[model samples]
Target: MIRKHDSLIHQILAREIPQYVIDERIRNILNFIKFGIESGIPANGKEDEDNNTAETSAFIRQLADDAIVLLKNENSILPLKPEENICLIGPGAVERRTTGGGSASLNSYYHTSVADALKKKLGHDVPFAMGSLIAKNLHDLGEVVTNPKGKGFDVKVYKESFDVPEEKRTLLENYSIDVSNLLLFDYDPKGCENSTYYMQLEGDLTPDKTGEYSFREQCLGTAQLFIDGKLVIDDKTKQGLSSGIFASPISSPQIVNVKLNAGQKYHIKVEFGSGMTFTARKDSAALVTDSASILNFGYIFHKTDEEYIEEAVELAKKSDKVILCVGTSLDYESEGFDRSEMKLPGNQEELVSAVLKVNKNVIIVNQSGTPVSLPWIDNVPAFMQAWFNGMEAGNAIADVLYGDVNPSGKLPLSYPKRVEDNPAFLTFKSNNGQCVYGEDVFAGWKFYEKRKIAPLFPFGFGLSYTDFTIDNIATKLDGENLEATVDVTNTGKVTGKEVVQLYVVPPKTTTAVDRPLKELKGFAKVELKAGEKKTVKIEVPYKYAASYFDVDANQWHAEKGEYGVLVGDSSSSEKFLESTFTLEKDELWSGL
Candidate 1:
């Protein structure tokens, strides 16, 4: 009431105002503004404190909940009842790769490993199982069978050493591992190509321990994976993650297969001679000694989906419900390149398929930035969309699964049924070492709508265990500002949170860019019980609804025409009520 009167007073005071009225209004506004600043708002100091997106830990929980997509649940196999004596199978069930390679990585104090998490949830008496991964077992074979032609593969004295390249697969030439003997880090600071550099091995490794070893220069060709005297992978194969920026980790867990007695000493040497030298990468090293990090991060490294299924089926049989936490590994997903396909990498799809054959009921939790083709989504009962939900992943998922929190996250991107459906798919492959993001801001949902191609899962397409109803889409215009209000109610048995979203559509003549039917302007996450309801008011300036940025004009132009306001759940399909509003050239911006 006072705010409206004050605005009126300001407009009416173009000529003058009573001295007493001016002083009283100024003092009230200042006092209210001061109180708001000191109240610990979300944004401050140039930050919009009114952005309540992450006002509390609920945002973390919402992100965690929304990212967990239950891919498969055949029978009532999930939310496993508390029964002891179950086994934890597969390499992943023990150690999880919370974060994959590249920029989306963060180091943290503690991470909840599935083993540790389950152990904490279930007591010490729970039985655990470890299965032989065919892929990893084959890796074991490669290391065990190869002896440099003289060390004797069957020698009882097992002394192993491996060189992890400093620059991912820096030695990746023609698809063959370009390994360097020098234990040094190599990175092209200037993006140099085929450059020569030198580094020396300074670690405790010696050459004499492996008997008399001599340098053998073999013509190694392209192949990410190479075996004794044979090239298993090469340039023609598209397993290109081994290229420049990937720095894919080698499957050399065999590094720990052998033992080195501390008292013994030996000298080892590998003469790089006069060849190109890249840095050697050290495996996940510890900050100190034998102290294990609270977080267990490493890949299960299954090459094919069949391999994943074989490992997963054994796990499903052992436990009451199958918590098949699966997704693409670093090799299949990373920066510099989009994925070749959108299907769940490896045997995840196949794993989900096969798991249903044995135990009809299973719960699939996935982690990825995009949607994967769930050929069998119709067969599954429960799903989760666990999209790289940072350090809070395991805790948040566990919290929701155990009914500790209500899932309130809305989708930020759309998921196509296949990689082919995406607009960038035609020209997406890495070309000339550059995968240009020419699509500009019109990516994901915007492009999909523009091209008339549909996404398998639309943006803001998150599912909640509860339901919400949005009513009364009304707008009020005061000068150049608009206030949007909608009534939201939780009309479900369970308590849940609702993401009240607001979207704005500019007039056709305002701008000529690829505009979405509506762009997300504002959203509010509110918690409510089964019979609870509340009116959420979201305010927007004409600038927010106006079309800005003209590539030709290099200036913002707002046409005096009609605009549309949409409020809904998903960016594409949802029951949202909309109303038409207007903007004028002069009303688009407020110099004030």
Candidate 2:
């Protein structure tokens, strides 16, 4: 409010906006605030509550069922029988990560972890283990902190990290907050004008289960963890930049192992510094004004990496098949920070590798918003990409695994074999304060097609428990749009959905500007039963396919050229049918 009001005041002083207009806006705001205060507060339900009704709930489940994409299925190992004994392995197995970290996180009415969902569906015990520790951040530690008043932590912001005497140190804000995760940017503390700021968080931690505990710190800047007055994890000097959107200035978790008994109390003090200096790649993006200041600090019940690996392998040996839930976590990939690399974080690589050696019937169910390097792709028989499906994360996985839902999701983005194969690899990050998009227009499949690079998984690639074939493809010009119609036949034994992708392959043009070899023009998702055939039509604007941005003219002009329509299930699908279409004359468009 202050910031907006200050801006308005500046505008009024500068006479940028009329005084009457500003007055009316201020009056409207005041009236709304008065009305809200007088009318009391409305009942604010949880985010999931809006869709908690029966119809909406079913639609949500279907949405989840449809969004899941099957990337690989070697020897037809998917759609596991419900009666089969399955061992759920990996940290994501029991954890209900229905959402990502930061602002994308959600508070739901109920959440069913994969372990719980599997148990419900199988109607028996589903053996599970923490194959790896994908530690929940400080904010997710809701019930562990025990203070005198209630469950919360005490926080104090200071102007400096050290050298200030306790009595002389100025207090910025000392308050009790419910969550451990703190975004200092939102707080906007006073008296800290420099790039650096410090914080001290005090809390009481009581272990519910007696076992070896591990504490770690993950922050954009630097931090130290002190348990019972003994320094455990210190990441003060370990500051670096990362490509991940949410986990920037990435520093590996500096963990410390400690043993504690159930119900035992420990005093925890976390000291933090908000800014760090680091050398980034010459092409790294500069720190924008809206860059995040995050603290994903917390500790979790710990087991040795070797211990986790052994237990998962043992579980895999006992079961008929293993549902190895693996992928990047919120800390590895999120909204603000781009991931530094494509590899899975921490000891996950070792865990999966060990599990694969003993179990050939391993089904890797990966959950991520984007691609992660799968070094063991060939070793696993089946793989599915369950990108952050909402509230029913576990139930959705069970639905697909138990053959209740046929996977029909298509990859929205291409999966690179390695980070180096990415079109923007050499110029992905910005240099100094400038970012150069060297591979403009030729992103994703276009880049791969142009460079003759084979992606691990091409864009629009997905498999189902059934089969589909695109036949009798036809294209016609209707008014200002090009209509491409194709007959989609489900020849397999089960009912499933398929996303029909339409790509426009332009002919050789005399224009000097660079252009992609082919571009996605339209797409449609159609469901069909076994032996059922449906004709699906996708419409693409004639100008969209025929036009290219003209820099000199500062407009988009449709070149007088011939183009062909490629219809298929995926970008790299060999089953595509081609048909040509032409534009009669040149056309120009301005102002999107």
Candidate 3:
């Protein structure tokens, strides 16, 4: 390949480029090729083997259990009793989103959904309802569709356009695909790698319930869905832009609803054109090129968001307690794109409000990697942040919900009540190809503290099954190092863990430079038994504890002042144990 593109490479690199740089680049590429040759590829079957072991599973479960943050436990509704009739509700309850999308996505060997895990622990199935549809696109048809051999679609490739008659089209290859979400960027047909092609996917979709079924189609190129020889959705000519695959501007998803009977099979056919046949103007922002095509086809028994919420409310009314599992998944939260808003997707907020009206014993468990605004937060009795925690997410969440594991996680960042409260709200997006960092150093809790704006939940805030107290705060300074020690005790009957946070409050500056009210310098997590006290010491260099980058001086400056050391479980000011230590002189340094 290098030899083939030799002239083109030379044409690009011959001018203005240093010879040594080009030689180094070539050497690096050769070394990478050599490494690949020496390593060799694994055996076909071994390459995809499941690598998870029993110990690793247990460890993962433990990590998930500890990472859960109990944001609110009003009236102590947590540590749920086993006898309570618990009802699991929402899309997250049934869907196993073990990871995010894009590069972070993976095909785990096995995963247990929250509904399944809870059912197993209760030794019986609980009343469950999908309160809302959080998925941006339609659900895949893999589970409901099948072919003569088994579950899957029979796919065929042709070196012709969809406009051509089936009899006149030249067939290139045919295969069976079990998944409807197909990414064929690297797919090369026997004789059609460099030519335009089309694909046809055929399967039998058997419905489990009689209802209005909705079918949705989205693709990188043009596509159309046909049910029993009837064209249902035409996504070819009337294409709009959408953030679907790779956060690219692909053809917007088109949907069509059809009535179907329970236990009855319907013929499903999808005609897909290659990326080259895309009708819409090619978008440079699209991560996928026109080498191949991408297709996502899905169908589901239709139900209105209101109807789903009503069903969930009915279930919640009868149950002694409710576990409202809700949050963004890979579809709405991923690497390729940023969420348009901070609210939960779909009518989830309405679902939460409706459920809360009927059940006060609801424990809302949100699973997401980032913070989402909760409008009904004040009314809920209990809330927990259970992030997308790998394969053992369900099992670990069940453990925490049932008191088998006490949550010890703290909020790493502040949760703003609204998107408008965010520090970067004004200049968050690009303005004519340039983005301004308007917030500057006032990011995270720093902005909230400096601006005197109270966040929904401050940084380092978390609730434990047991209570803890931090007292007897003392500070000492030795040279450039400052150490703060505090006594943390578990006051409640249950054993729990406490994170002792040490925040440094810089003295009022004499110059024009502004500083935050306080900044977290160091922290220590301590496990304490009931009535047990432990002296946790957190030490930090004075420069790191109270330094700000002096951009003009090209150095970090620690102002000479009496720095206040505040020790607390959270960043909230009211919970702190304060003390003071003087730096005596200003210090400026560059390298770390």
| Top-TM-score structure, candidate number | 3
How well does model 3 score by local distance difference test? 0.83
What lDDT score belongs to each candidate, Candidate 1 first?
0.50, 0.77, 0.83
Give the alpha carbon lDDT tens digit for every residue of 313-357 in model 3. Answer: 999999999999999998877765777899898899999999999
| 250: Cα error in model 1, Å | 10
TM-score for each of the candidates:
0.61, 0.78, 0.84
lDDT string for model 1 (1-592, tens) is: 1223444557567646567786897899999989988897645345333533444445654566655643333352444555633444343444334565444554433345455656666665344333323221122121112233332121110011124444432332211111221111233223224333222211122222322212211111111222222333232122121122333222112111122233343222221211122122223221111111110001122234454456657666766555555565443455534566776643456666777776655555665666678787677676667666655566665665555565666667777777777767766766887877767767778888777887767777666666789998898676757778889999977888877777888776644566566687777777888989999888776666665565566555565788888888768745778887875444333332
Task: Summarize candidate 2's per-residue lDDT along 372-490 as a digit string, tens digits.
Answer: 88888888889999988887778898899888999999998999989899998999887997999888888788899999999999999999999988899889999989999999999
Instruction: Name the runs in model 3 displaced over 4 angstroms.
Output: 1-46, 143-179, 182-206, 226-231, 237-247, 264-271, 283-293, 476-482, 510-512, 541-543, 558-561, 581-592
Listing every candidate in turn, what is its Cα RMSD in Å to the true structure after a full C-alpha superposition? 16.6, 6.8, 4.6
Best by lDDT: 3
Model 3 lDDT, residue 42, Cα: 44
| TM-score ranking, best first | 3, 2, 1
**Candidate 3 collision pairs:** none
